[model samples]
Target: MYNQAMVIGKFYPPHAGHAHLVTTAAAQSGKVAVLVLGSRFESITVEERVKWLAAEFDDVDGVEIIGMRNDCPEDYHSDEIWKAQTELMRLALKSHGVTSIDAVFSSEEYGDRLAAVFGAEHVLVDPSRSAYPISGTLCREDLGASWPHIIAPARQEMATRIVVVGSESTGTTTLTKALTEHYRPRFPGIADVPEYGRQFTYEKFDTLRSVVPDAGIQDMVWTAEDFSVIGARQNEMENAAADVCPLVIADTDSLATTLWERYYLGEGSYGSYHAADVLPRRDLYLLTDHEGVAFEDDGWREGEHRRAEMTEWFKEALTAEGHSWILVTGDHDRRLKTAIETIDLIVAQRSGFTSPPWASRSSVARPALEGAAA
Candidate 1:
């Protein structure tokens, strides 16, 4: 008989201790299955809470938290339906290469019954930090008082993940969107930066012109640099929540701002404004070609050659800095297709697989799946 481990719990917000138990049980034998008793309903949706769990833990491996569909009436909890659910869990374990439950890991009352069903030994793990050793029902009633201490003890270390960056009107937004649509269904985790062009254009473009008059280069430069800083900071703070996230597709990286400062300043005024130290570092850089895509005529200086020149200059600067940048050109659809294909290489380099993001990046063993940025 194939050896297996069985674990069960409500895991309202499956904390670190529960995660540790799940991983340990799975490591003991062929497979480890976790049965979530009250997984379906709560104030917070089950799906929303699970994502929080994945971010809380760094990696998702060999852990399965099964949820049951609502086949019965919402007003009643049927014993017949629940017995069937438990039996289905047992069958699922057997079908998924689990023969015996090496241990039952829990800090709840149902721990014994969970082990007995599988004929597996029950192990009481140290629930040192769990909110309530008895159950979460009483504690959740007046959550305002006991909530913080229960689930979130204090601050936890965050994952310092990298974000991609580039310049505006330079295809940063399009590329990020393309990469997301390209790999969303295939990858376990993905991230992207918010697009500021449309936002800035829609909200502040007119107001700045009327008020500042001489807004000139300073105005546009301020807009670009300011947005760059905001975008990078926002990404770092949120993406830090997950561990081993697939990759973050940033709209505009820091170097783009450096390039902007270099472009606006005349006669080597690059050192006068600021240095490039503040820009957040990225694992990969994708430089976009300027093909006379968009133009700003009324407010700022406009020329086709100037746009192309800046694109060329930024690429050269990035190249000198020992960074990798892919030059993508053509219309939106054409450029998007090229970007999706090229990013496949970047993802491959990270995953250690030669196949594309569509064909690879996902694994049968990888459980605790989390969606990309919403």
Candidate 2:
């Protein structure tokens, strides 16, 4: 076993192959430093890749993950470029008090030269790619097909999150369910997160009924704390769903729960509002319009007359919060079609990955770098 080892890669999305390389290094070394390199040309940020890998290997001992931006042009033939790249790698390793590496672990051919620079031996693993037939290039080319290969933390960031929210009886649940069904063929693990507020409401009322058998829905009191609980649970459920699927549909999100807090606990209430500020990023929101849709008088629902007003509140809050949203109208079928078209466009746009300069820098032009920023 080596005293100190190093692994270096762009990690782009950190697929299973990268994990294997890191784990292999960790197994053979007392200390393994994984350098996550990033370039401006790439879409995924260096910080995000570092965080994902850190989480992925949190349980593993002797693995240290570090992120650094390296915009140096890829020219293995040039001694000058090699010197500059090795200096950056050394600085990153030294930050973790690794003065020298005994071994350099990598799947690339340049591992020998990198190890020589650090006065370390080269240890190549899976040079033929037989162990895990995946790469950053393959993941960038077809993210959906490579979903299973990506680490869970990275998957959460890459997933296309669609949230359906609106006032009561406006078909938010129906639209979320339909959207999940629409994307299930391509994203088999995709699922719609049910409204936690509704479930909470059911339980709250049941608890009240246990004490007073004749208690009705109107007697149920909604406090700021209740909305906060709803908002937190919504975020947890959404995150759990996104971890397993590349696409996740939700009936409502924490952001929507804030407006409901105002609706039930008066306009000044901001308990749920602050709680939702730290929730995960959502890609698209579909607001179900209350027009032409008659409100159903469910025994638990008392918002038929206030549907339009609450719908307007959702629109205003969504815009105020700087979230991307679209209004869905007409019959259920038409709404589904409109949602599908919009989501398909978003998914297509997000899935297109720009390879780092190291991969295909010849075709792409990069601005001259003044100095090393990492």
On lDDT, the candidate that comes out on top is 2
lDDT at position 107, candidate 1: 53
- 181-217, model 1: which lDDT tens digit per residue? 6765664355455644344544555677677776654
For all predicted structures, in order, the TM-scores are 0.43, 0.86
lDDT, candidate 2, 1-374, per-residue tens: 99889999999889888999999999999989999989888888899999999999999988989898889888899999999989989898888788988999998888899999999999999886666777776677657667777888898888888899989998988888888887889887786699999899999999999999999888988898899899999999998898777788999999889888888888788878765888787898999999978888788788888999999998888898898999999999999999999999998877877764466411111111101101
Those runs of model 2 whose alpha carbons end farther than 4 Å from true positions after fitting are 57-63, 75-84, 91-99, 128-133, 268-271, 356-374
Which residue segments of model 1 deviate by more than 4 Å? Answer: 1-170, 187-191, 195-245, 266-281, 292-303, 331-334, 352-374
> What clash pairs does model 1 have?
4-100, 4-101, 5-102, 165-252, 165-253, 166-252, 166-253
Candidate 2: deviation at residue 72, Å?
3.5
Name the candidate that leads on TM-score.
Answer: 2
Per-residue error for 65 in candidate 1, Å, reads 30
Could you give me the TM-score of model 2 versus the true structure? 0.86
